[model samples]
Target: MAEQIELHEQAPRLKSVSSPQDQDKGTSQQDDVDDTGITEASLTLEEQTDLDARRGQGFEAYPDGGVAAWLQVLYCFCIMFTTLGGVYSWGIFQDALHAEQLAPSSTLAFIGSTQATLEGLCAIPISALVARFGNKNVAVVGAILSGLGPILASWCTKSVAGLFVTEGFMFGAGQALCFFCAATLPSSYFSRRRNFATGLVYAGSGVGGAALSLAANGLIKSIGLPWTFRILGILFLAINLPCAYLLKPRPIISPIHHGAQGGLTWGPVVKISLLKDIRFVLVLIGSAVALFPLFVPPFFLPLFATSIGLSSGAASSLLAGFNLASATGRIGWGVMADRWFGSLNSLLLCLAANATSTLVIWPIAGRVGPLAVFAVINGFCAGGFFSLIPGVVSSLFSDDDLPVAFSMIVSLWAPGDFLGAPIAGYLLQAFGGPDSGYEAYRPAIFYAGGLGVFSALMVFGARVKEGGSWRRRL
Candidate 1:
C-alpha cells in the first residue's frame, strides 16, 4: 500500500491496478509456500484482470515473441549499433589519432574516458524520461546527437582538443541516451525471453563493431579520415532515425504487483536509496571495478596488436574476430543464464573466463595465432559480462524497481570508464618497449584481471549474503 502510494505520487495515469478495496474483500492467501520456504502471495484482482484480458482477447502471452517484441528488439539493436558500437570501435580512431595526428597516448586515452563518462552520466535520468515522455522522444533526440557528433568531428581532424569535444563528449552523451533506451525499452515488450532479447540487442554492438572495424580499416586507408567520419555520421543518422520512430514502450510493461503500482514518476527525482543496500552496493562496486578493465580491450587491442608488429590488416582481422566472438558470446551466455546457470552464476563464470584469458592467455599472445585466440576468448567472455548485467540487476530487485536499479548500475559505470583507459595508457607508456609491447601491456593486463577477479569475488560475496548459499536464487 505504501509502495502504491509512492507510485501514485510518481506517475498519475490510468494504468490497470487493483484497488485498495480489494484487500478488504476478505481473501486469505498466506497458506501457499514454495520450495524455498517463501510464501506465495495470491493473485490480485488487477492480475486476474490482466490474465483474463489476455486470454479472452487472445493477446500475446507475457512473452509475446511476435512481431511487436521482435520489432522492439530491432529498435534496441539499432540504438546499440550506433551508441555502444561507437564506444567499442573507438580504438580505431584512437590508433589513427596516435599515428596521423601524433597525439599522446594518455591524452587520447583521457579523451575516450571523457566520452565514456559523459555517456553514462545520463543513464539514470533518462530512465525517468523514457517512463514519462515515452521511449521514442528520448530516442529521437539521441539519434540527432549521435548523427551530428561524428559529422562535427570530421572537420576537427587536425585538432585533438576539438575532436575531444566533438567526438568524445558530444558522441558520448548521445550514446548515453540511446543506451538508456536500449536497456529499458526491450523489457516493456518481453517478459520470458527478455534475456535472449537483450542478448540479441547487445549483439548489435558486436555486429556494428565488427562491420565498423572492417569499414574503418578500408575507408581510412582508401578515402582518408574526414570522409570516413562523414560516412559514419550519415550511417548513424540513417539507421537511428527509423528506429527512433519505430521503438516504443508497450502498456503491458506496466504491471502491478498485488495492489502495488507500476511505472515510476516521470519526474527529475530518482531514488538513490539502493546505496544503502549491501547487495546493491556490492553490485555497484563490482560493476565499476569490472568496467575499468573490460573497456581496455576495445580502447587498445588494435594498437596493442600493431605495436607488436602485426600489420594493420591483421590487427583489423583480429579485432573483427574479437567482435564476432563477442556477439556470439553475448547470445551464448545469455542463453546459458536463462536456461542453465542463472544470472549470478553465469556472471561468476563469465568473470572467471575473462580473468583467465587476460591473466594466462594474453601474456603469451605475441604471435598471430595466440593473439587471435586470446582476442576471441577474451571478447566472448567480456560479452558475457555485459550481457548478464541487466539480468543481475533484475534479479536483485522487483520488476517495478528494475528501472531504478539499472539506472543506478549504468550511471555508476562512468567513474570506471573515465579512469580505466588513462590508467592503462599510463601503465603502457611507462612499461612498453620498442622490442616488444608485452612488457608494457603486462601491468594493464594484471590490472584488468585483478579487478575482474576482485569484482567477481564481490559479486560472489553478495550472492552468499543475499541467498545465504550458492544454491539460492539471486
Candidate 2:
C-alpha cells in the first residue's frame, strides 16, 4: 500500500515537468504566424507600436548625411533644377519665341500651358509605375527622355507647329520625367524631416530656373535660339546623369504571397479610402486652385518687364530674380514648416501672405525696385505652398497610401494647370500686350491674389472644423 502511494505521487511530479515543454511548443507555433510574409495583420503588437511612433516623428527614415541618402538628395536637386527651372524660365522663352519664331502672344502661351499640364497629368501614371517598378529605374528612363527631348527639338523645323511638337510635346515630356523622379524619391527617404528635405529639393528648381534663365537669355542674345537650346539640352543631360544613379526606394518586404508580383494594385481599397477622406478632397481642390495663379506671374513676368520699358536682357534678369527669390523662399519656408510650425498651419500663413503680397505689392510694381521686391516676396510666400503640401497630405494618411494620394492630387490638378497660363494669355491680350502697356496683367495679379485669399479661408474653415486654431498649431 505504501509502494502504491509513492508511485502515484511520482506520476504527478512527471506530469508537472512535461507541462512546461508543451507551453514552449505553443509559443513556437505563435511565432511562426508570419512565416509567409510581412503584412499589417502579421505584425506583432510591439512592431505596430514602433511603426506608430515612427510615423509621429515625421520623415525620419532617411539617414542623416549617409552617402546614399545625400546622393539621392543631390540627384533630386538636379532633377528639380532642370524640370522646375525650365518651367520658371517660361517667361524668357515665351517672350523670345513670341517675338522671333512663334509670334502672337496668345499662340506662344500654349507652349507653357501644355508643358505645365503634361507635367502634372503625367504624375498619375508615373507615380503608380514608380511604386511598381521602383523609382531608380523609372527616373533613369525619364531623365533620358527629358534630356534628349530638347536636343531633338533643336533639329525640328523652327516653325510654330514644329516648335509645338518639339518644344511643347517633347520637352514637356522630359520635364514630366524629371519632376516625377525628384518629387517621388524624397518621399522614400525621410519621414520626419520630409518638408525640410522636399523644400530643399524644390528650392533647386528655382535656383535651376534662375540660373538657366540667365544663361539661356545670354546665350540666346549672343548665339541665337537654336544653339542656345542645344546648349541647354547638354546641361540638362549632365545634371540628370547622377540622379539616375542615386535615387532609389526604401526596401519594403511584402507579406502577401503575390504582393510583389503585381506591384501596387489600384483597388477598392484606394478608391474607398480617398473618397471617404474629406480633408484630402479639400486639400486637393485647394492645391489645384492655388497652383493656377502661381505659374501666371512667372510665365509672363519677362514680357511684362519689356512692356514697361526694360531691355530684353533686363527683363530676362527680372525673371531670374523671381526664380532666385522663389528658391530662397522654398528653403526658408520649408525650415519653418518642419521645425517651427505644423505643415497645415504654415500653408495657411503662406496663402495669406501670397495673396496680400500679390494684391498689395504687385499692382504697384511697375517700377523696377518695387517689382523686384514683389517678386522676392511672392516667391518666398509661394514656396510654403509647394513645400507644405506633401507633408500635410502625409498627415492625413499612412505611408502605404501616400503614392496613391499624391497621384490623385496631381491628376486632379492637370486640367487647371493646362488652362491657367492660356487663360492668363487671353486676359493679357484682352487688356493689352506690350503695346497697351501691361494693364491686362495688373488685373490678372488681382485675380491671382483673390484666389490665394479664398484658398486660405477654405483652409481656415477646415482648421476650425477640426477644432484647432491655426496660430496655436503653428
Backbone clashes for every candidate come to 0, 11
Q: Per-model C-alpha lDDT, please? A: 0.73, 0.68
Q: List the residue pairs that clash in candidate 1.
A: none
Q: Give the per-residue lDDT digits (tens) of candidate 1, residues 1-474.
A: 011211222222322333344546865434333223332234566744654454333233344488888988988887887777887777778778778856866677676677678756877677766666667788888889888989999999889878888888888878877887777566556655566778888898888888886788678889988899999999999999889878766542322222224434333334566778898888878877888888777666777888789887887888788898998888888888777777777888888889888899887788888888889899998888777888777666655666677877888788787887667767877785433566678888888888888988888777777765566433
Error of 2 at 126 (Å): 1.1
Cα RMSD for candidates in order: 6.6, 11.6
Query: What are the runs in model 2 whose C-alpha is more than 4 Å off?
Result: 1-65, 251-270, 469-474
Q: Write the per-residue lDDT of candidate 2 for residues 81-134, one digit (tens) a residue.
A: 887777667666766776775577677778767777886778767775665566
**In candidate 2, how many Å is residue 471 off?**
5.0
Give the Cα error of residue 339 in candidate 1, in Å. Answer: 0.7
